[model samples]
Target: MSLAFLLLTMGLVCLVAGGALALNVRGCAHALERKAAGNAELAMHARGELGQPQLVMSARLYRCLGTVFVLCGIVLTPYGFLELA
Candidate 1:
């Protein structure tokens, strides 16, 4: 039961964090778009280096990752139940 409770708590934490991250990404969509465009331009101008634009943040990537995390948390939270019967 203790372990189950621990899992449940961790799952809830993940869910909250993932939801917050997803919402944050949505709130900053415009800024992310501009940053992405700048990164693309920088990448196009790279001559000898193919990794010049490694500092850019991808909104789609974060959104998908967050969604996956939220899903995992949802699954985990339910699995924390001590008994189904």
Candidate 2:
């Protein structure tokens, strides 16, 4: 009983976290992109046409991770219910 309840709670937490991240996906991506763009401009100014690598966090990474978390939560919630059954 406790195990099932714990699983359900964990699942709910994951779902909520993933949902929040998904909601901010666009804004996060845009901010990262802007930062990268600024870095790129600086690189071009200093590197004389040679491009320097910028560490940019891609929006896709957040989306994929959030998707994974949501999927885990969805699977877990069902299993938690099944445990009660």
Candidate 3:
């Protein structure tokens, strides 16, 4: 396959991976909130100065995946352009 095709394929893969990560993170956050809601202590703790560990971890993962996707897209664009040249 041509370099352009390869780049496009990789870019699409990154986007899909990032989307999946984001969805997973959102799901986890919701679940954690729901679980914490049942326990007043947990809910209070989550709302206090210290945030929910699970939610924070999930957000970090989502952020990392999003950054990777963006970087991949940016890199692939140049590669695709070069291939066309």
Candidate 4:
């Protein structure tokens, strides 16, 4: 019920979400590889380069977000626990 407990809960939620994001990204990358197959352009995009740059950017963004979320969750949860105790 305390602020600390709220922070802890939010932190855990973020951590879990981050983990899911990571898993999703793994699947996405695999799918991209498969889709690229023998297409030079598509393969370039899959490699995060000269084709569909957005794909690369998006993947990087998601990965960055996942890391940030997990880190924030780790920091917040411990701090919340300390406050609660």
Candidate 5:
């Protein structure tokens, strides 16, 4: 009804979404890790056996998104709760 309540709802939604996203990302990262291990030579040959840039980037993006969503939830929840009270 109120702004605070809305924020609280939004924040909770973000938290749930973020958590789900993070889990999916984690799975992807795990898969990439396995893939990279399989083709380490070619995947990292250009970079002197460093790592696969695409996989790394994908994992990073997911991680960053997850963090952002969770942080959003963390930042919004308290304000919403306090204001609602």
Candidate 6:
């Protein structure tokens, strides 16, 4: 029972972190898009390389965090059962 509760708490924490990270990454992309649109030189530079790449990297990182959270939940679930046994 204690293990179950612990696992649940950890799972919730992971889910929250994943969600926050995902939202932050999306917000960053939206902000960048808006910034790029306002100035032609900025837009051209954004299109050239660096700007889009960073956004993509951040998005991938969030995706990885979400994946890790899910995996941790799965792992903890079985471990919780073992603890009960």
lDDT of 2 at 41: 75
lDDT of 1 by residue, 20-65 (tens): 6667654654466567878786766775555545545577666676
lDDT of 2 by residue, 43-79 (tens): 8878787665565667667667777888899988988
Q: In candidate 5, what are the lDDT values of residues 1-85, reduced to their tens digit? A: 4999899998999898776666765486456555665665575676676654544446556656877898899999999988978
> Worst 10-residue stretch by lDDT in candidate 3?
49-58
Q: What lDDT does the true structure give each of the candidates?
A: 0.71, 0.76, 0.62, 0.69, 0.73, 0.59
Clashing pairs in 3: none
Give candidate 2's whole-model lDDT: 0.76
| Per-residue lDDT of candidate 3, residues 1-85 (tens digit) | 4878888778777766655554655575345445544465576677783543443334455556666776777677677767877
Worst 10 residues of 5 by lDDT: 51-60
lDDT of 4 by residue, 1-85 (tens): 5899899999999888876665665576345444444365666767788644233335555656678888889898988889887
Off by over 4 Å in 6: 12-57
Ten contiguous residues minimizing lDDT sum, candidate 1: 48-57
Show pairs that collide, candidate 1. none
Task: State the displacement of the C-alpha of residue 69, model 2, in Å, after optimal TM-score superposition.
Answer: 0.3
Whose lDDT is higher: candidate 3's or candidate 5's? 5
In candidate 3, stretches whose alpha carbon ends up further than 4 angstroms from where it belongs are 12-57
Query: Worst 10-residue stretch by lDDT in candidate 6?
Result: 50-59
The candidate that achieves the highest TM-score relative to the unseen native structure: 2
lDDT score, candidate 3, position 37 = 46
- Name the better of 2 and 3 by TM-score: 2
The runs of at least 3 residues in candidate 1 whose Cα sits more than 4 Å from the true structure, single-residue gaps closed, are 25-52, 55-57, 83-85
Of 1 and 2, the candidate ranking higher by lDDT: 2
